[model samples]
Each structure stands twice: as C-alpha cells, then as structure tokens.
Target: MNLSCGIIGKPFSGKSTLFALMTGEDGGGKFGPVRGMAKVSDSRIDYLSSLYHPKKTTYASVEFIDVPGVSGSETGENKMLEHVRNTESLLAVIGAFEEEDCDASLQGEIQGILDELLLNDLILTENRLEKIKHQRNPQEKDEFVLFSRLHEALEENRPLRSLDLKEDEQKAIKGFQFFTLKPLMFVINIHEEAIPRAEAIENRLREKLANDAHTGVIALSALIEEEIMQLPEEERPAFLEEMGIGEPATEKVIRSIYSLLGLISFFTAGEDEVKAWTIRKGASARSAAGEIHSDIERGFIKAELVHYDDFAATPDMKKLKEAGLVRLEGKEYVVRDGDIINFKFNV
Candidate 1:
C-alpha cells in the first residue's frame, strides 16, 4: 500500500508531461526527481461517504517519483539507477507520436529500454560473479554456482525478472536488486489521432508486454491530457463525455499501477470518518489491521465484515443486522476489494 513507483524514460520522451498529468501538477523546473502523492480514485469511497455523511473522508494514495531522463552519461545513468532502485515499480514513458521520420516506434522504444535494463543487470552480475569465482572458500563456491547460472540467463538476453527462484534462492540475491527484476508498467504516449488504435496497439504488444505477471501496457496521449487539464473544472466532465473517455490519464495510470502491483482497497465508514485503505490482494485480516495501527493488530480478536454490495443494499446498520449480512471473520480471512470491515480489538 505504501508502494512508490519511479517514472523513467529517455530524453525527449513525454515522461515529464505524463508525470504532470498524473500528479495534477506542473513538472517543477528543477534538476532532481519530482515527487507527488496521487489519489487512488474509488467510487466506493464516494458511496460510503454519501451514506455515512462522515465528518472527514479520505482516499488511498500512492507516491510517484519522476526520475530525470537517463542517456549518454554514465553518471546520469547511475543517478537514475539509484532512484529506480528505491521504487517498488517502474513506469517507462515512450514517445510514440508519428513524425516525418517516425524513428521512435513504440515497439522499438520498449525494446531499447529493456536492452538497457538487461545490460545494467548483466554488468553487475558479471562483476559479482567474478569476485565470487576468485575466492577459493567452499561458501563462496556455492554463490559462484548460483550467480553463474544467472550469468547464463543474462547472456541469453533473458532478464532476471523471468526467473522463478525458490524462496531460499530469492533470499540469496535479493540484496542485489537487479534493475531487470523490478515490475514494469509501460506508457506509450501516442499521438492524439492514434487514440482509437490504443486497444489494437496493446493487443499487438501483448506478448512482449507480458514481461511478467506484474507487467502491463497502456497507450495514452499526453497532448490530450494536457489540453483537458487546461479546461475549467466544471467543463471537463462534459469534454471527457464528448470524447468518450471513461477515465483521465491520471486515473488510468493509477488503475494500471494498482493492477500491476496487485493492490486492493477496503473501506471503513462511519459518522466520524469514511476511509479507504489499501492492501495487497491476498492480505489477511490481521495484516490489514496492522496497516491501520500496531495496537489494533496486536489485540486483534475478530473482524466485523460485510461486502460493500450488501451494505449498499441495506445501508443502515440496523437493516444489515436484520438481514444477517454482516459476519464476524477471524484473522485468517483474506480481505477483498470493496469489503467493509471493523476490527474488534481491546488494547
């Protein structure tokens, strides 16, 4: 839920523009990374707020850091790599607009970026394996064997992300945090005219886009998004309606990120507050409670649970009780999206 993603791309790409559109802010005129906290839009939160009339309502948010473009300089690449390593995921922004030359095709751009990532991992792995090989110690020999296998994969242009390492093996090389191992989500900043072909483009790249279980592809026009942002708040909805756009660039990015990271939201509503909480898709009730506070998790007894659908039908607590829709769930219960939960705890 606290996951932060890094926005990365080559120079001349719409990385900064996409960052501005996603964060609902101007890309600051500075040298370093621009950080923003973006709301995870949810209709369920609005429904809960209307029903409960909470004094204060909150939506879940995710952090995004816009890393400066990386290109020729090794120092620049190193700086960018540092930021990339700090993030839980990466969003690669590729400029896919049709130019007179049309040199930067979407497929070619993605392939180039991926090649750079692989090269970065390859260099690091080779260096570490060389050190391990030079050591005669039996413990070092075991590490040499594992890293050598990794070296073979890198040599074949296979990224570390494709590897399905065992739990113990995962523990072994986790510290390396190889560049190619991070989950990736791509944005093809296509021309406004190409909007209709977005689905086709995604379908065409589906095989390549399936870089791993946590990878996805999105085609968007930052040009359109920028224009939309310039419109008055009252006029924007109608504009989007006329354009046949269900979601804005920011919303699409947020949804893609949540899906890529396997995040789900749960709600807690009352007169005091209606809040949306984020958790991993398969997070247990106890673990979700810990997200709220350590004390609640420590003293956990049971969770008062009901799907938001049931609560929506019988919004009143009295009605929900009458229908026996609300149930008590133990800590082992896996929280689902749109679940309404109240922790029963004494501390």
Candidate 2:
C-alpha cells in the first residue's frame, strides 16, 4: 500500500510551506487541501536512474496532504478532525520560531492539541464500551476487555499504542480509528539560528514520550526547507552541507515514516519501466503481486528474482543468470528489499 502522511499545525505555522517542499509544488493558498505525491528520495532510485537514464525515471512516492490546523475543539470551522481521522500517519508541525524576544510556548500548544486528540479517543472508546455493555451475550468479550484497558490508558493521558492488545483485540478497535492511536512524526519548527539545537529538542520530546511506539520527533527550520526548495536543484546539496544539514527535512521525515510503518521497497526493472513498489516487510510474493495487479495475484506463478546488491555488482542480468544469482520463488516466498522481480503468470 502507498504510504500517506497528513501535515497539520497551527495557522501560519509553515505547514503549507512544508507540504510545498515535500511535493515540489506551490501549494500556498488560503482554504483547501493541497494533495500530491512525493518521491521517497531513496538513494537506490538515484543509482538506478543514473545507470539506466530511462525516458521517465520514477521513484516510489508517498502522498502528502495539507489539512487545516487543529483548533483544539471537536467542532470547528476547519475540518481538521475529519482529516486527522482519515490519515494513516501524522506530521504535527509545532512552530517555535521568532525574531524578537517573544516566548514561543510550544509545549502548551502541543499539550492542548494532544489533549484534544486524547479526548477524541476517550469519547469514541466510551461510546464503543457502552455499546459492548448493552449486549447481554457478546460475540467477542475480548474486545470489551481490551477496550476497557484502552479506556483506562486514555484516561491516564496515554494512547492505545501504549497498551499491549492482542492481534484480534487490536483489529476490533481498528474501526474506531482513534487519532491519538496513529503513528506520529512531530516536527519542531525551530528558528534559523537554533537549527543546530534540534538534537536537544528531539531528546526532550523523546524523554517525555518514551513509552509511545513508532513515534519520532525531529527538529527542523521550515524557513530552511523553504529556502532550499527555491534554490536550483544542483545547488541544494552544497547549500545544505554548508548549513550543517544532511538532507532536506522532507527526506528525513519520510524515511523515518517508512521505517516506522514497516514498509519496504522491491523493484521491477526493464526497458519498459524501472519502478519501485512499496510493500510490507515479510510480505509474500503473491501478496506483493496483488499490489501491482489483483489479476496477477489471483493467477499465481513463480517469480524470477535477483537481489539488487548482486545485480549492481554484476551490472548485467544475463551475467547474474549465468552466475546462478537469479532464483525463482513460489507464491509463499517472502519478498526482500532491493529484490528485482519479474512475475510469470497465466491469467
């Protein structure tokens, strides 16, 4: 499945600017969602593109949507609650920038936003628990038990991820789609001078959120990303290196998101199309086939594969075949990262 992240923050908090940088578009405007795809910016794509020089070199992409900021309310003019509900992951941009000696109290704002999310979850959990209680003979009492635990957790200002629910218990609560339960990437928008101080901020957030699973906090200057995006593509790397930045914030955040989501990439290369496809780690060949096409999955067959590292070393598919680097796997074979595949099937 394609990964997606919803960008949200306070009004005038550079949320749209970050979205523009991520999607390479001018998405700055007043009142609507600007949505588009962003390349995952994997080095493997760059290496492959350099080698093949295809008419259209495509990298795997994730969808990014800029939703209006949360207003710290369940009912508001902005549909941020709806956006948060629909997103698989979140990128909460907290503004901490200033020119004057004004106190940028992000902790309070973040606490308020978090409180809203927790309240949303608590309300939903309570409603569901009430429903389960109404049933005299429940189909699955485990759901009630798990949800009760979750309710208690939320009551203590903890998210569902903090609980150890069974797989079935987790599935049972999936339909609720609590906002606080989703994977979160907190982006702290620091001042330009404090760009070097990001590590400290990350450490602080980490200390406070030690128990949350798959949570990441990154410090970045949105102004820096905005400036870098405006520069010519060739000049970006040198500018970033001079500024003591390794990569664009978009790349850094997206890479972290991919890791947190447990997504991996496998390739299908040819003169026709050299493409990257996202799949879950340990996904079977048949399941991956369904990502490309449902028909290909239904008509299961063997897959010709070559490990990407081995292929790069040989620099020739025919040579790899000759060297026995090529292998064929049945439907149950687990797909690995950088595996070049060709599915043979009869539908």
Candidate 3:
C-alpha cells in the first residue's frame, strides 16, 4: 500500500512554500491539493545499487499531499480536515515568519491546531454514534461497541492515537480510519532572523511534547528552503553550512515521519535491478514477498537472505556464499532493517 502524508496549515502560513521546496514543484494554491512523491533515501540501497550496478534502481517512497491552506471560513477548514482524515500522517506547519506572525504566541498556535484536530475527530465520533444507534443489526460485528468507546474518548478531548486498542478490537474497527489515530509532526516555519534560535525552539517543543507517541517537532526557515531551491545544486551545500543548518528541513521531517510510522526498508538485489521495499518494522518474510509480488508470496518458498552489512563488508556474492553469510529462511522469519532477500518461489 502507498502511504500518504497530508500537509496542512493556515493560509499564508508558509505551508505551500514549504511544500514547493520539499517537492520541487508547485503545490496547489489556497484551495486545492497537490500530490507529490518523495523518494526515501537509504544508504544501504545506494551501496547495493553500486554493488549490483543494475539497469534499474528503485527507492521506497512516501506520497505527500499539500492540502489547501485552511482558513477562518468553515468551508476551507472542512476541506483541510477532509484531506487530513485521508492521510497516514499529518504535517502541521506553524508560521513563525515575521510577515505572517499575526499570532504572537507560537505555543498557542500549536494548541489551536491540536484543538481543531480533536474537534474534527470528535465530530466524526458523534456522527458515527448516530449512525450506529440506528443500525439494523443489533450484533453488527461489535463495531457499535467499538465506536461507542471511541466516542467517549473523543468527548474527553483525547486523540484516538493514544488509545491502546487490542488486536481483536483493532480488527473490529479496522475500516474506520480515524484522523486522531494518525501520527503528527509539527513544522515550525521561522524567518531567517530566528534561524539561530530554531534549535532552541524545537528543543522546547520537544520537551513539551515529549510524552506524546508518534509525534515530532521540528523548526526550519522556509525562506531558506525557498532560496535553496533557486540556487545551483553545487552551491547549496556551502550555503547550508553558512546558515548553520546540517540538512534540509524536508529531510529531517521525512526522517521523523519514518520513525513515527514504524516503517523500515529491506532490499532485493540482482543483475537486473536493485530495489528497496518498505514494510512495518516487525513484518515477516511472507509479507515482504507480497510487497514484491503476490505470486511469489503464494508460492511460499524459503527466502535466501543476507544482512546488508555482511554483503557490504564482503563485496562479493561468491565469497559471501562461501563464508555462509547468506542464509535461508521460512516465510515466518521476521525481516530486519537491512535485509537483502531473494525470494525462492515457483509458479
């Protein structure tokens, strides 16, 4: 499945500007969504690509949608909320630039975003309760019970993400993808003047939001990112060094999103192609095979696997095999972060 993230913030909040920088394309204006694909960079993939020197090299990617800038009007806010509900994660941009600093209190703006999200989920819960109450089946697969509990939690101003739902309960309500259940990241978009204080602000937000699971806080100058976009590729590194920024904020944001989502990549290397595939951290071999192709998964043979570090160190397939670094595993074997697997299967 293709995972998606929603970019959301108030109008004139540097939301679109950041999206443009991150994507190198025009994210839609104040009223529409722009879809962009961002490649997930992995050094392991790069190393394997060089080793194989394959005709095709693929990287795992996450799709991001720049939702229309939310405004004070109910229509715009509803549209933004609709987009947010459809994503696996939410990137909330807070405008700290002097030009857009109508709200002086950064923390208050953050709270307002949280409140809006909670209220949106609360509305969804209430609507679901009303529908469930009138359901034709009294024993409707326990969904009514599940949603009732969710409604209670939403009423308490708690996001559904914090709930520790068990396996069975999770299955029961699997179809209802709740907004509050998605991970969230806060992007503090500051001006160049605030660049030096950016880390300090991020640290403060980190301390304040430390207890929240699947949440991250980051600070960046969207203006600097815009300038980076307009500069020549060779000059960008030196400019970043002078600006006291180690890497682009988009990179940092993506890294945080990966950690928040508990996603990891494994590889398949060959003379024809070297590809990177993403899966949940604890995913099994069978699931990884399914990521490649369903027929391979259906055939259900053992996997020939090697750890990336082992392969990188040896640098030769023949030597690695002779050293017994390549191992065989059944479908149930849990995949690691840097596994390079060849699925041995038949039609």
Root-mean-square deviation of every model: 2.5, 2.8, 2.3
Local distance difference test, candidate 2: 0.79
Deviation from native of the Cα of residue 289 in model 2, angstroms: 1.2
* Model 1 alpha-carbon miss at residue 178, Å: 2.1
TM-score: model 2 vs. ground truth: 0.89
| Best of the candidates, lDDT | 3
Q: Give the higher-lDDT candidate: 2 or 3.
A: 3
- By TM-score, the best candidate is 3
Specify the poorest-scoring 10-residue window by lDDT in model 2.
99-108
**Model 2 lDDT tens row, 85-190:** 7767877888787744222365565666677778888988898889887666656476777778888999999877677777777677788777887888888887
Which one wins by lDDT: 1 or 3? 3
* TM-score ranking of the models: 3, 1, 2
Candidate 1 at 14: error in angstroms?
1.5
Q: Estimate the TM-score of every prediction.
A: 0.90, 0.89, 0.92
For 243-276, candidate 3 gives per-residue lDDT tens digits of 9988877877876887789998888888899998
| TM-score winner between candidates 1 and 3 | 3
Clash count for each candidate, listed in order shown: 0, 0, 0
